[model samples]
Target: MEKQTPTLESSSQPQLKLAYLRPGDMIDVEFASATKVRTKLQLVGFDTGRYLLLKQPNPRTEGSYADVLFEGNPVIVRLVLEGEAGECIAFKTKIRAVTNFPFRLLYLDYPEQVENRALRAQKRVRTHIPVDVTADNNQADNTKKLASGVIVDISSAGCRILFKAQNEGGNVTHMNIKVSIGSGSQKDLLMLSGQVMNQKKERGMISVGVRFTDEEAHIIEVFDHLLIDTEFEC
Candidate 1:
């Protein structure tokens, strides 16, 4: 059997009337709070009914704030964009934070969908990609300066890391995280400043959620290529 080739849609014309979002576009959302929490969300699915389905980059445990409703409404969110040609993209589905607390901001990737027309129909394509990560903890003892942790997963804006720590120290809400991407021969490293958005303590295990800073927006492209390539390869 012959391998099927994927089709590329024209990028010249804009399909959807979405604000700050285009198909295959990744963006970060910031929340208002003391911690300045943020999460990574991916635009996996969409509904023309003024809403889109955003997949949470991390998984949440039971009885967590992510399980509860936001603003007295369900955890499902809708993007209410303002300005000329305002539009609303509703996400009627529930999302789990993969963490314990709620982060104020979220990073999201919007994928475009094709609409069926008189002569052409829409089809779904898969892409595959990979991400590289490096995290460090400055709180380690003075003599032993080392950061210990492994990234659980990553999206366009942020990532979830699993670290081993016994307790929280004083004045340490942010950490230095580095991420990179590339295939066998080509690799690119990106340095980002992140803050601890949420912490979960269980015995000897600690999971932390972190979001990228405004200056780190450039890294989203590396992540997007990894995701899209990974999907296609798979």
Candidate 2:
């Protein structure tokens, strides 16, 4: 896949908060007006400190909010960073421009500052656990496919898994998957459900980051067992 390099802004603004964002990431935009409209839009591109470009909301679905999308309107933007750096970022800016000629697009003034909060309260612990991960394919058929991988590190919130690229194809974001722990008998298998948050592919292998939707108690149980096993072997 060809990665798009975001347009770099001038050096005048040393602290470019929006530089961390990428095209196609979902952003929550709140128009600070009488109606206080809030909606989600996919990021189209950005020019560092100059402007943040976003795909205009679909006319058929989100045309109602067009009234609040005028120039100089105050806007609050937010996006969540998944994977190792789990954080939610928010910034304040204004609608810089809006266009519908060639394409429907919305532009906002580059934020001067950004605020972020950590999503994971607990620190991640490093370990290796053999497992089987079954991810839902992004097709109309809704097939369940399995892959053998190793959970390289984990925390109460999520974990990172390493598996061969041939095991699972394409982007796995938002795909429902189950991490099966243990082996041999059916009773020995401990299944944990989660959605694929992010992935990195290199050297014929892919690293998957997953945030578990299972209860904290269950995660703690697995965490304790893994830790104890590690200590015993040490």
lDDT of every predicted structure (CA atoms): 0.40, 0.74
Candidate 1 lDDT by residue in tens digits, 1-234? 332222223222336445444343332333223333344455544545335444444444322234222332222233433222223343322222222245333222333442212211211122232333344554333222224555565544455655566455322346554434444534544344466665554457655556666354465555444443212111
TM-score of each: 0.31, 0.67
Candidate whose TM-score is highest: 2
Which whole-number lDDT from 0 to 100 does residue 84 have in model 1?
21
Task: Show model 1 residue runs off by greater than 4 Å.
Answer: 1-146, 166-171, 175-188, 214-217, 228-234
Scanning candidate 2 in windows of ten residues, the lowest lDDT window is: 3-12
User: Could you give candidate 2's per-residue lDDT for residues 139-227 as a string of tens digits?
Assistant: 53765656889988777778889988884378887778888889444457777888898876667888888989888788677656555
